[model samples]
Target: MSQAWLRQPERGSVGLLRFAAWLAHHAGRNATRLLLYPITVYYILTSPAGRGASRDYLARVLAEPPGWRQIFRHFFCFAQTILDRVLLLAGRTDGFELAVFDRDGLLERARRGQGCLLLGAHLGSFDMLRLLAVEQAGLKLKILMRPDHNQMITSLLAALNPAVAATLQPIAGPADMLRLRELLAAGYVVGLLADRATPEDRLVTVDFLGGQAALPATPIQLASRLGVPVFTCVGLYLGGRRYEAHFDLLAEQIVIPRSAAMDATRLWVERYAAQLARYLKLAPYNWFNFYLFWQA
Candidate 1:
């Protein structure tokens, strides 16, 4: 479904998130498997169009499916979603461990009271990172998200997790840069997705997963403008209802190196792309780019 459909009154962001949490808490592994069986069968039989589209795109990107392995990969992805929702509902804070790479590097920068920007992908349970920031690091996190398409989901999340609702700040475009700047000025950690670029956004073309892809340049631009450090975080699901959140400092200071001349954008874009590929290779199924990404 398009994210726009999520805006339906009954499925507002808050409501949908709460429902997800409820399912996570109530559905055990076996129960969730049984419940998802019908949906799986239906998708397998009725989603030929979508499957074909995905197949075509994969072929163009030189990522063609290896027969049954690809099928199992997609199946595991569907199953992972069920498990992720359950974990979110269970709220078992200590059940998982965060394996932060180059953490001290980021921490050292954070201690300067200048704040930092966290650029992440939609690969894993992004929401879970909020808890780690607040509960583990004692840092206030502000998430920039697109406004929920569904009012019902939004309302439900507001009612069930007020803290999360309070921290979520939705922005539509670069006009919201002032707010982001203000947050950084106040030493608050700001996190945003950096893999998707819309028409109104600045695009940074990079080599990713053996192909050229475009990524949103807002995160890099904002960090450079604000003089804040940038970090890339990747969350990996390690099974048994656990996840490992990895954080790495991407840049100590996003200075346009003198030697790069007019190629500064390309330099930074490649850096980000290389790091992203590394993580995705570690958890291929976790890469959640559902739409055509490497083309157009």
Candidate 2:
């Protein structure tokens, strides 16, 4: 179900993002936002895969078949966040108000100078989480992701603010892994989107939203190896330039003994998936992995 998402094409080009950014800066948020309507509708009609995926997810979450209006809202939410990403990366949140909930774990970790793995899903705007957490909490946050995952989007954001690309530690090679080790040992918080897996990644099936799906086991594996605490984070878009960030400690420390490595990994992956499910419920439309997740 997910290999295709890994192989899916990037929806927008760098030129599009540059134009959107220019519009936001010159025309302003309200006027620039007017473009999202036609853009969202274009995707709904052209990208049948995305449209069908949205409908399927809504069907399960709403407990019935969803209509065109609901599907359009889902697409609109996704488009809005994407448009805002340009501004968020440019360190502009003037129009947005963020409310963080239950961030004690992150604050405590920072106070102790203990590094952590902040595990987040495709839900909501992770750009907001990284922005506000560092701004308000004063945490040195670094992101670990597949560098080539979305070269188009990555390039666009980097063009908007080059430092955004500099902070990302790509997991495409072992050197990046070694760097991640160093960052954690040096007591810097590292964030990862743990829900999707690349072709080279490992997976473990877990129950999510009433069905089983393959979640990337790499995050748990690294935590077990690094001996760092894991915290589940979500940056839920509350619409209209408002967001609510939620952080809950998932594992104070993931200790997987060698003998029971298999069992231990399964336990934590399942735990993460369950926690992700809970966060999805808080902002159903915020879920942004526009791919079928449940295993057939």
Maximum-lDDT candidate? 2
lDDT (CA) for every model shown? 0.62, 0.81
- Put down candidate 2 lDDT per residue, 217-290, tens digits, no spaces: 88999988888888988888888988988888988889988898878888899999888778777777887878
Residue 178 in model 1: lDDT: 85
State the lDDT at 12 in candidate 2: 41
Q: Can you list the residue pairs that collide in candidate 2?
A: none
- Cα error, residue 138 of model 1, in Å, equals 0.7
Candidate 1 overall Cα lDDT vs. reference?
0.62
Relative to the unseen true structure, what is the Cα RMSD of model 2? 1.7
Q: Per-residue CA lDDT of candidate 1, range 1-296, in tens? A: 22212222331223324444665568745565555555554554554543543454344433555454464455456455545544553454544555544556656655666688888886666666666633367676788777734345445557656766677778876678889888888888888887766455577677777767777776676677778888887776655556667787888788765576337866786788788778666665566554456643
- Worst 10-residue lDDT window, candidate 1: 4-13
Listed in order, each prediction's TM-score against the native is: 0.79, 0.94
